[model samples]
Each structure stands twice: as C-alpha cells, then as structure tokens.
Target: MSETSELLSGLALGAFRLNGQFLQIAEGLARPAGITPAWWQVLGAVLREPLPVAGIARVMGMTRQGVQRIADLLVERGLAEYRPNPAHRRAKLLQPTAAGREAIAKIAPGHQELADRLVGELGLDQARQCLEALHRLSAALDHFTDHP
Candidate 1:
C-alpha cells in the first residue's frame, strides 16, 4: 500500500475507536437521565433556543428525518415542545422544556469532569492541537457537502 493509503487507514481506525468511546460515555451518562444518547444530543441542541428541524439536523450533521424522529421522541416524552414557525409553515421550531434543561444541566458537571480527565491524560496543549486538527478535517469534509 502507498504511504497515503496507510495513513488514511490508521486515521479511519482511530476515528472509529474514538467515536465508540464517546458513544459509550454518552450512553452511560444519558441512561440515568432516562434518555438515549441521541435524545440527549437533541436536548443539547435545543438548550440554546428553538430551532427548525432542518437547522438542528444541519448542526448535528444528521439527516432531517433522523433529527425529526428524535424531536418527536422528545416531544412525546414531554422533554421538548414544538412551536409554530412563522417563516416556514411546515417546519416547527423545537425548544427544550424545563425537564430537558434540567437533564442537561445535571449532566454538564460530569461532562466537564470527563473533558478535564481527557485533557489531563492527553496534555492540554496536545488536546487543543487535536481539536484544531479535527476542526480542520471537519471543515474540509463539509466543503464536499452542499449544505452550509
């Protein structure tokens, strides 16, 4: 294999492993709050303010249907509520409820602790560099997509 191919393969494998670890942590943290990792993500997205489904999907890098499914689940669970959108007749805006906010607030401290642990293990400077590299990679990949 060429050097570029070998490097790409290693990067792919590392990304997979890191994603697995992240999901595992998210799952564990979400379970006690009576939510799945996906639901938690939806709640986090709405924590700032109401957003259209498409907007949320774009932010989360997920399909609209996938985000809609999670939004429906959140609404059904009474964790989030949908408001009518003035600009878009069909698209409703999503916002977290008190319960949803509370759930995220509860998890924030633990999440911060986990972040601190990771930073410590990796060294703060190294972790910052890693984040910068990932951001650059994300931007490069995003350029391929039509979405902004």
Candidate 2:
C-alpha cells in the first residue's frame, strides 16, 4: 500500500477508537444528571438555538431517526419541549428546557476537568493542533460525501 493509504487507515482506526472512548467519558459525565450521552449530545446542539430533529441530526453528524428518538425522550422527560417553527410547518423545533440546561450545567465541572486533564497530558499546543487537524479532516470528508 502507498504511504498515504497507510496513514489514512491509521487515522481511521484512531478516530474509531477515540469515538468510543469519548462516548464512554460522556456517559460517565452525563449519567449522574439522569441523561445519557446521546441526550447530552442533542442538548448541546440546541444550546444556542432551537432546531428541528433533522437540523439537530445534521449539526451533530448523526442519523435523523436516532436524534428524533432522543428528542422525543427528552420531551417526555421534561428536559426539552417542542415549539412551532416559523420556517417549517410540519417540523417543530426542539428547545431545551430550564431543567435540561441545569442538567448540562451540572456536568460542566466534570467535562472541564476531563478537558483540563487531556490538555495537561497532551500539552495545550499539541491538543489544539490535534483538534484543528481533526476538524479539517472532518470538513474534507464532509465535502467528499457531499460531492460524491
């Protein structure tokens, strides 16, 4: 195999491993507040603005059905509520409730602690560079998928 192909394979493997590790950490950080990692993810997406399920899925790079399921659960639990969307008649926007914000706030300390530990281990500059590289890779992949 070419060197580029080998590097790509290694990058893919590392990303897959990192995804699972991050999910595990997220679960640990969120479960104490009675939300799953998926719930936390959806809530995080809408922290700034309410989004329809499709919008949330797109923003989070998740399947629409998966996000919809979680959104429904959040509404059922009173952590989120649906409101009429001015843009789309059929699709309602999911807005995080005060309770949802409080739950996420409760997890902030744990999240910040983990972030600090990772930065300490990796060194801030290295960690930032890694994040920038990963973001660029994601953008490239997204472009390819869009054009393909």
Quote the positional error of residue 18 for candidate 1 in Å. Answer: 1.3
What stretches of model 2 exceed 4 Å from their correct place?
A: none
TM-score of 1: 0.92
Error of 2 at 128 (Å): 1.1
Off by over 4 Å in 1: none
Candidate 1 residue pairs that clash? none
Q: lDDT score, residue 129, model 1? A: 99
lDDT of 2 by residue, 1-148 (tens): 9999999999999999999999999999999999999999999999999999999988899999999999999999999999999999999999999999999999999999999999999998999999999899999899877688
- Give the per-residue Cα lDDT of candidate 2 at 13: 98
- Cα deviation at 70, candidate 2, in Å, is 0.6
In terms of lDDT, the poorest run of 10 residues in model 2 is: 139-148
lDDT of 1 by residue, 51-87 (tens): 9999999998889999999999899989999999999
RMSD of 2: 1.0
Instruction: Tell me the TM-score of each prediction against the true structure.
Output: 0.92, 0.95
